[model samples]
Structure formats: structure tokens, C-alpha cells
Target: MKKTMKTTTPITKTLAAAGLAGILMISASGLPSAHVHAETKAAASTNRVTAPTVAPQLVTSKTLQSKEKWLETNIKIPVFQGLTDTKYQDQLNDIIESHASKDMDKWEKEAAEAAANAQKNGYTMHPYQLTINYELTSDGKDDSLISLKVITEGIGMNNGDPRVDTYNFTNEVEAQRVTLEDLFGKDYKSIVDKAVKTAIAADQDQYFANEDGFQSIDAEQSFYVADGKAYIVFQKYSIAPGSTGTPEFAIKLPGKGSDKKPAAAVVKSGAYYKDKNGKIMVQVSVLRQLQFNVKWNGKSKTTEISKGAVWSAVKLNKDAYTLGKMAPRSLGSAPVMKKGHIYVPLAFLTDVLNLNADHSKHGQITVTAAK
Candidate 1:
């Protein structure tokens, strides 16, 4: 987002809001709003996971003075302690330094050009500034995953959108870079597309329409993993108005909290019965509790389930079902029609939709939508 610089003084503190001269503000604690999660005391005891904390050290600071221009630069790098493999740390340092050096040079050139113009036109010039700061998203201690968000802000002739570069690394000896597919598997693209679209759907008016809005996340989309979720980030004005800042959607990461016992379903009232095959069959309408829209087509005798960009189709007495454009897979048991309602195998939730379908001792099925 665009952060305005007030006057020409050196910026020593993180940005805050005021008026046109206000700059982007980060939390005083350096924790992003996206990382905040609330859990009950009982649940916290059962599933306790803490992110690694690292200290940041100021590495570069420079200032330039001239008759008509004043410029300042600041850069800080994170310091990792008790690390066996230093490749990840070394790589991140190099990348941040490289970016800072390039930006400093560019800002210097822009300042000189601006100063010359001010002298000729007899107008005062504002200070030219560049600053690079970082927030630690993840460290490799607990999950062998390291991620960081590096923020760069420049102020000279105009206010520009902050450039954020996210670095994700696997804590291997060689320090391999992590990709969306590596984190979410083969269906990474589809999974991200559905999650982003669903988040945007929450307020479509906040974003642009047609082609100018979001089309799809690229294979190399910007992301960072934190709090058992991978967040997909969009640049300012890329998909929405600047007032929205940088939009990010959190996708539940695979295998997160799997070791811990599944929490009780928040809302667990659904009609389900066990068929002769012993497979739990749930009424198609029950999916509504999990935020799925179910539609019945009498002309084609098909049932469609949709959530944002993801959809699934199944037909009566059909042994197969299709999810999105993927090939059809056997449902193990075809949908059963009874009492003017359609009941599909529990696999419809656990297998096809990738939801959590847990059976309690009392014959009730606990359905939980993926976060």
C-alpha cells in the first residue's frame, strides 16, 4: 500500500495514519493481524503450537545531504539463533541486501533528477527515503518451514505501493525453496483458486469487475505459511481498491493439527444413516451446514454442489461423481433416493469435498468445513 512520508525528516518509527501525509502502519508488536488466533483453554492445551521468534538487527543505514535534497536509507535483517544449517539464513540475507542496494541506487538517481527540476522551476523538494523491514512468518524449528515477509517502502517524487517479497524455505541442508505445490500437493492450484474466490466473494464490491479483477493465482503466487495456514497475498490494486491494502486469504494447510484430536463440530446436527454396506449415507441437504449450496436438476437428474469456484456433480443411481474438471471417481456406493431426499455416501464429504467427516459413538456424523 502507499505510505505517505510527512515532511523530510528521517523516519525512526513504524508508520501510522493521519491524513494525506500518513504512512502505512504495522502492529507495534510486529505481529500481523492474520497471525492472531483465539482458542479455548482446553483446546489450547490439546493443540499447542508456538511460532519461532527471531530478533532483527539493523544492518544498513545511510544518509545524504545536499543543497536542495535530503535522502535517507534504512535496512534491517533478521538474526537466527542456534541454527545448524545456515544456508537459509545466508540466502535470505543476500536477497534482502541485494534488493536494498538496488533500491538505494534507484532512489539516489531519482533524488538528483528531482533536485535539478526544483532548482530550475523554483519549487521546494521533499526528502527522498528508502526503508526495508521484515516480519517473520515462520521458522524451521517445529515444522521445517521458514517463511518471511520483507517490506520495502520508497518515498521521493510520488507515493508508491510498498513492494513485499516473501521468502519460503525448507530447512534442509541445501535449503530448497518451497512452492505452493510442495505445500498443498498436486491440487494446489485448484485449492488456492477456490479459497481466494471464496474470500473475495465475501465482498465482491470491494474488488474490480471483469478482467481487471482477479482471474486466477499464478503458479508462482506470493504466499507465506503461518498459524497452520498458508496465506495467498495480492498486491495493492491488483484485485481490489487501494483501501483494501494487500489482500490475503488463509487456506488451511494439509496435515495441520492432524496429530491432535479433532475438535468437536461447532454445529453438528445432520440426518445420516448407515446403509447395508455399512457406509454412512448423509442427506444431500445436510451439506448446507458446511456452507455448500446444493442444487437439484430435474431435467438431467443430477445434483450439483458448489462453493465459490469449486463445484461437484453427482447423478441418481450413479456410482461416480465429478469434482471440478477432474475425472469422475467411484463414490463406493451410488446415491440412494429415499423419502423424496437424496443420500450420498459419507465419502461425498470426506473424499470428494475434502471435508472432515467424523462419526460419533451415537451414530451422528460430525461435518466440518475446511478452514
Candidate 2:
């Protein structure tokens, strides 16, 4: 995590998209910023639960920059490489494609405009550069998480400090990308809101303006993972002007909410159930608690959630689905709707949300965030 800056600027009103020569800027409003349930710790302890074992890493670094008299572009994009598993390697590449090779086109163009305009004003624009970096937050068989950071500086022409944009990703199931909504369950919005405000309240001196000075977490904030924790990220000048530098708060899953004992099968469903295939299937009601929604118009049904993000269950056969294109999935049995309730495979949800479901010897099933 990058350190927050000290010098502060009071944000009176929303800054305009106004720009200076060769300076491309976005207002602070749009910025970066999820949850999970845990299996019973009592059972997990007996099962010997622990963080996923770290695996060997594959690294690939690319430096692309061009410097001229008036305009300059420097970018450092490093992604994981040397993946032995082609499935995962391809997954990494796809993510980078969306972040850098594709996203940079607009940034680069903005830089050029800033340079050309600055030169016309008899000023040599600050050498504009942006760095795209990837940090390995967590490594695992079920949950491998990565954080991507893109920093742009020198162009803003203010304190000349760089603005930060962080994005987090989990390499899982080959086809599907895990989202925060999937991990923490459906109430992530409120969960994050409480968590962030709580952090800000603890260190009120660190921020400016009112008690609600900081905006609530958005759906698409960039975050990173490290040491089995998820850091909700923010850019410099975003929440507390430049003083806060970049703000990151590790989300604390409340683990409070019904805390209902895992559900049973014969009862026809309310929480989780042991499926006919002997797999635990989480009830949609709990999915609702987790922030996952299942919408039906009486024709087909759709499931949506944020587990790290817009995870949609696609390719429905019977019990099998792609689990939203990020996961390679085959259901133990197709999900079924019984008496207005929907059921999903526990294994599938655990993988998508980056959680671990432990079956204890005492006939208990515990689901917790993957650590």
C-alpha cells in the first residue's frame, strides 16, 4: 500500500474537469473502493484452517516511455508472467489487456493534448508519465488475488503529486473473475460504508471537512490484497485532499447477521443445504444477505453480485454453469427453485467469493473468507 501524503488541501466544492496546458484531470468524485461469511471457527479450527500456501510466482515487466522537449510519457506496466498453467496465464493477460494496452489509449491522447497546448503558451509541460503496476496480494489454489495500480503525476501541474487508481483481481476458476460482492455477501455496500467511516472516525485528524467528508465506496473502486486482507483504496486528493495521499482501509467483515447455523436439506431451504450430490448449497436468502440478488421474471433467472463484481451466472444447463465466465464450473446438481427459494452450489460460491467452506467432524459446515 502506498503511503498517504501530509500536506493538505481543503475541498470546498466539487472540482471541475477544468484542465491546464497539457494537464488532463478527472474530478475527485469518481474513485476507487467488499465481504464474506466465515465457516464456523469451532469447526474450522478442528479442520486446521489456514491461509492458502503461497505458490511460485511468474513475473513479466514492461517499460514503455517516450520523452520529448514538451511532452513525455513514461509507463511501467508489470504483470505476472511465467505461468505454467496456460489457463491462468491467459486470465492474467486478459486483465492486463483491459487495464493497460486498451485503457492507455485515452490517457496517452490526453497527455498529447496537454503538451501541445502547453507549448503554445510558451511553457514546457511537465514530463507526463503514468505507471501501471501489479502487486500480488494473495496467492492460492482457490483464491489468488492481484492488485493493479496506475499512478499519473507531473501532468496535473499542481503540487506535481501523482493521482492513484488501484484495481484488485482474483485469479480463480479459469473463466470467472471473483468480485467483492461474492466474497462478503450482498450487503457489501453498507458493510463498506460502515467500515470506511469507522476508520475515518478513528483518525478524524487525518481527514478534512465534515464527519462525512469522505464519499462512500463506489461499485468500481480499485483495491488490493495482501496478507489475507482486502484494502479498499482511494487516490490522493480524493477523500482528504493531498494530505491523506492514498487512503486504504482493510475491510473488517462484521460476521454478524443471523449467524444462523448452516441450514438443513429436508426443510426445503432457508440458509445452506446439503445437496443430493453431497455438496453444500447456499440458499439464495443468505445470498441476499451477502448482497447477491436473484431476479426472476418467470422465464429465466439471473444472479448478480459484486464478490471483488458484477458476477452473473451464465451458461445454465441443469446444475452446471460457467459461474459468470470467470469460473469453470459444473454443478454437482443444477440449482433449483423450491417454494420461491433459489439454491446455488456452495463450492461455486466459495470459489467466486474467495471463501473457504470447511466441513467439520461435528456435522457442521463453516464458510469464511479465504485467508
Candidate 3:
């Protein structure tokens, strides 16, 4: 019989939940071999005994600070114990440490430049900051496998871009890096491509135009496994606006997506036309297919769509819409009354519902779920 296992917990989420601020980065010893098989044999019988788990440890480095440059650094590097092959462990640590050091050096110079510029220009500046943190996402039983993320964040400098490096290793005589193909087979790209497109289509407002923003995952794309699922990660602003930060797409492989079926497609059509601003305006009734209850208050000249606890109301001829308890945001275009029926922008309505529009196929619009 075949067997597979993976586990991980991202520390960023934990810190965020605790209301801790600042970003993280990691460094390691060296790079290991580039080849690692994804499969391992199970015991002959289910009753076979197993040994106690030997987990990896996090070793904190001495905090480094430069008062003149207004910069400070903090890092936590990983160390593996009791492994027959410690080469990979050491190399992983090296990689994390090296990355953190390089980043700090680069940011330190930039911070100094910013400080001089601020002094010359007679202005105050925020102090430069750097932090490196790691998330030990998963360690297979008996130390068969190890997976983790090296998170790096820089602040108050010239383009302190956030970065995450994923490392997957096999605890054997020789350590090897795990590739996407090893995790999901040869058709990995197709699976990831579909998920990426689906995600962008679902959240159109968050991403730039698809044609220019993202095409597909590269052969050496960064990824990590956690909680029985794999996540494909893109750098900040690579596929979306800066507000989106780093974009991640979660995909379940055969062991993942096989059990659950895709959501049924919902199709609906209404008279649509390009407005003066070139926005697609459709009949308000189309929202019904999205499971939104539309109501019109003739006296107040308002239209409201409610679904459970989430509700949005917009006044006729107004370019603002109230979503639940949040402040009003622009609808881009105001809803208008045409022949006693309400018409709204297709983009606005679909965005509010968190769905995507597909005009590639039939004349009708097909809505799909987003991340």
C-alpha cells in the first residue's frame, strides 16, 4: 500500500492573532542536493511499532542593532537534533542565516541613505527595522521529512520587500530538496494554473489585469505544505495590487481535491451594456442567481441586497454602497432605474458577492467561488 504524510503550522498567523507587529525572516547553513523522492515505504503490517518523534528546534540569534543607522535586527534560526544525516539540517540553517544577513546589510545601507536625505531635507524619518522568523510547518513521523518557511520583512528603507523561502527535506543519509513535481506529479502545473486563474477571477478587484499580472506558475515556483494542503506563493505586487501583500493559492492534490467535488456552476443572464465609463451594467435581478435577496424601497429610492448577516444597501443615483457595518465604498457607478427596473454595474455586484465574471464562453455570466 502507498502512504503519504505532511503537517505544518505557520507562525505568522499565531503572532497576528496575538496582535504582535513587525515582519519575519530566516537564515540557514547551506543548500542541500536538489533531488528528493516523494515516496517512502510503510511497515509490513499496520501493527508495527514506531519510534518517538525527534522534532527540529529554533535557535534564536543575538539581536543586532545599529543606533546611527536607526536599524535593528532579530532572527530565529532552525536546528535539527538526533538526525542520522545532519548535513541537510545544517545547510537549511545556513540558508536562513545567509539570507537574513544579506537582507540586513542591504537594508542598513538604504536606511543610512534615507537618514542623510531626511537630515538634508529637514524632515524626520521612521527607524529602519528587519526581523526573521520561521514556521516549522511539518515534521513527518520519526523525522522522515521536514518542511518550513523562512519569512523576511524589512521596513523604512528602499523597497524592503517581504519574502518567504520554503525548504522541504528528506531525513536520510543524504538530504535532498523536494520539488513540486515530487509532491503532485508531472501535471502539477495544470493543477496550479487552474487554481491561480480561478482565484484571480474570483477576486478581480484585488488583482491587476490577468493577462499582465499572472500567467502560470514557474518550474521553480516557491511552495510549502501545511495542514494537509499545499500553497503556491507569489511575491508581493507580482500578481495583485500592493495592498494584497504576498498572494498565496491553496491547492489540494490527489490526496487533497479527490474527496471533494467542485461547486456546481451557476449561470444567469440579463440585459447588459457598456455605460459612459465603459462599465458593464446589468439588470439587478441577475444577483438573484448569486443567492442574494434584492429589495427596492420605492419611497427612499434605495436598493438593498441581503444574505444572512451580510447586507449592502445603495441609494439610487448614489455612487456609494454600505456593506454590513463598514463605511461606504465607491460603487464606481451609481445604480439607475430603467423602465421601472434597477440596473447596477456587473463588476460592482459581482465584487460585492466575491465572485468572478466569465465572458469567455456563453453570452450569459457564470459565477465561480474565490479564495
Position 308, candidate 3: lDDT: 60
Model 2 poorest 10 in a row by lDDT: 16-25
Predicted structure 2: lDDT: 0.45
Instruction: Assess candidate 3 and give its TM-score to the true structure.
Output: 0.52
lDDT of 1 at 38: 24
189-223: candidate 1 lDDT, tens digit per residue: 87678767666665577678888988898865777
lDDT of 3: 0.55
Model 3 lDDT, residue 13, Cα: 28
Candidate 1 stretches with Cα past 4 Å from truth are 1-52, 55-69, 79-83, 257-371
lDDT of 2 by residue, 1-371 (tens): 11111222222221111000111111221122211112221110111112233333544445544333333444544444543335655554555444444334555566677878988999867655544433333443323344334444444433445544444433322222334564465555666677677667666666665754776777655554444445566665666665455566765332324242112211123356676679776553344333343333234554434343445563223655554565455756666665444567776656555556666665555554455
Error of 2 at 13 (Å): 40
Whole-model lDDT, candidate 1? 0.58
Q: Which of 1 and 2 is ahead in lDDT?
A: 1
Cα displacement (Å) at residue 353, model 1: 26
